[model samples]
Target: MKYEGKIVLVTGARRGVGRLLAEHFLNQGAQVIGFSRHEDDEAQLPGYTPLAVDVGDPESVARGFEQVRKQFGRVDIVINNAAVLTSQYAMIMPAGAAKGMLDANILGTFLVSREAAKLMRKSKWGRIINIGSMAASLEPMGDSIYAATKAAIATLANVMAKEFAALNITCNTLGITAIETDMLGQLPKDKIDAVIAGLPLPRYATAEDIFNVVDFFASERSGYVTAQTVFLGGVN
Candidate 1:
């Protein structure tokens, strides 16, 4: 119960990595709040609340935070896990697809982190962890927009680390490798296999692997750590 009494907010928590993260935090004794475009039955779980929040929209995000303030009074840790990915060659990528990726991956992280920092300031301690991707460093073919958005995630966290330092809030990025998620399932199996084969570990990452890193970043002992990006599978 290291996170006992902590209020954790996870974006895109309807499914996939976001949902897994919400569960993990709850098990650690946190009061978990999940933000998704739509809520689900899992919202009924003890210690977890799901809110409909489109992080890409400023107003929607603001309303979500308002609800959080009213219900939890504050946010202590935030995992910016909301993102949209499309793997397509730069030449053939649709404009709307690129824009959607930018909005969900980049703008979403920015808006959530900004609001999280504000709520955290009350207690003068917080953790903002952005879910990045190995694609950023790999720069895989046909992943121009997706990779760029991920790379931007790391950059955004780094800058926020400095900006939020005075508030005792640390910001960092966790660049995960391929995992069994609906999003990853959208990619070609052959492509994912090829990429994993080239990795130092050469295997699919597990939910435990992700949660381990998250725990480290959210640890009170890690207050001195900020502006860092840790990539799984030794990508960087």
Candidate 2:
């Protein structure tokens, strides 16, 4: 288990990508702390402690990190997997929706990453994997605001990688197309069909697909792979 004894923090762990990520890390023997606004007691995952925190608020994010540090000596890895998606056409989207997207997707990621880096700096080695999306590059319909937030995540990874290189902290973005998650279950069939049709592989991503990438990022070989945006899309 590469992550044996390592303390890994994963945000948005109640469901979807985040939950899968936390499970994978724990399976690798990592002591994982999951932060989600909702409480998911039914999961009963081994070696995982769930912390309730609203990442969209800086205060909540900070407090969550404090709790993590208090419980686990140090945080070795952080997966910024928590995000909110607003799929609305640019012309019809209201200002309020745009603001909410910015608060949760962009600002929340910043706050969590910043706090996690502070803890990692003391540990001398760390891995920060940001969960991004193909929407940032593909610019899909009705995804303008969501795409903008993920693009900011890419930028955050670039700067954090350069700034923390000396401290042995690697920051990278894992950009992927749609995955089969409860979140995507909300979408209508036509929309999902259109996305799958455009995919070169003719299928959507799975939680396992995203987990493989995260595992790679947390490996020792990834030390030299900082600042890179790795696309999980099968096309290229």
Q: How many residue pairs clash in each candidate?
A: 0, 0
The CA lDDT at 150 in model 1 is 96
Model 2, 135-176: lDDT tens digits are 888787898999899999989889989999999999999998
Per-model C-alpha RMSD: 0.7, 1.4
Question: Taking the tens digit of each residue's C-alpha lDDT, what string does model 1 give over 1-236?
Answer: 89999999999999999989999999889999999997677578899999999999999999999999999889999999999998999999999999999999999999999999889999999999999999999999999999999999999999999999999999999999998999999999998999999999999999999999999999999999999999999899
TM-score of 1: 0.99
Instruction: State in Å the error of residue 17, model 2.
Output: 0.8
TM-scores for all candidates: the values are 0.99, 0.95
User: Least lDDT summed over 10 consecutive residues: which range in candidate 2?
Assistant: 227-236
What's model 1's lDDT at 12? 95
lDDT score, candidate 2: 0.86
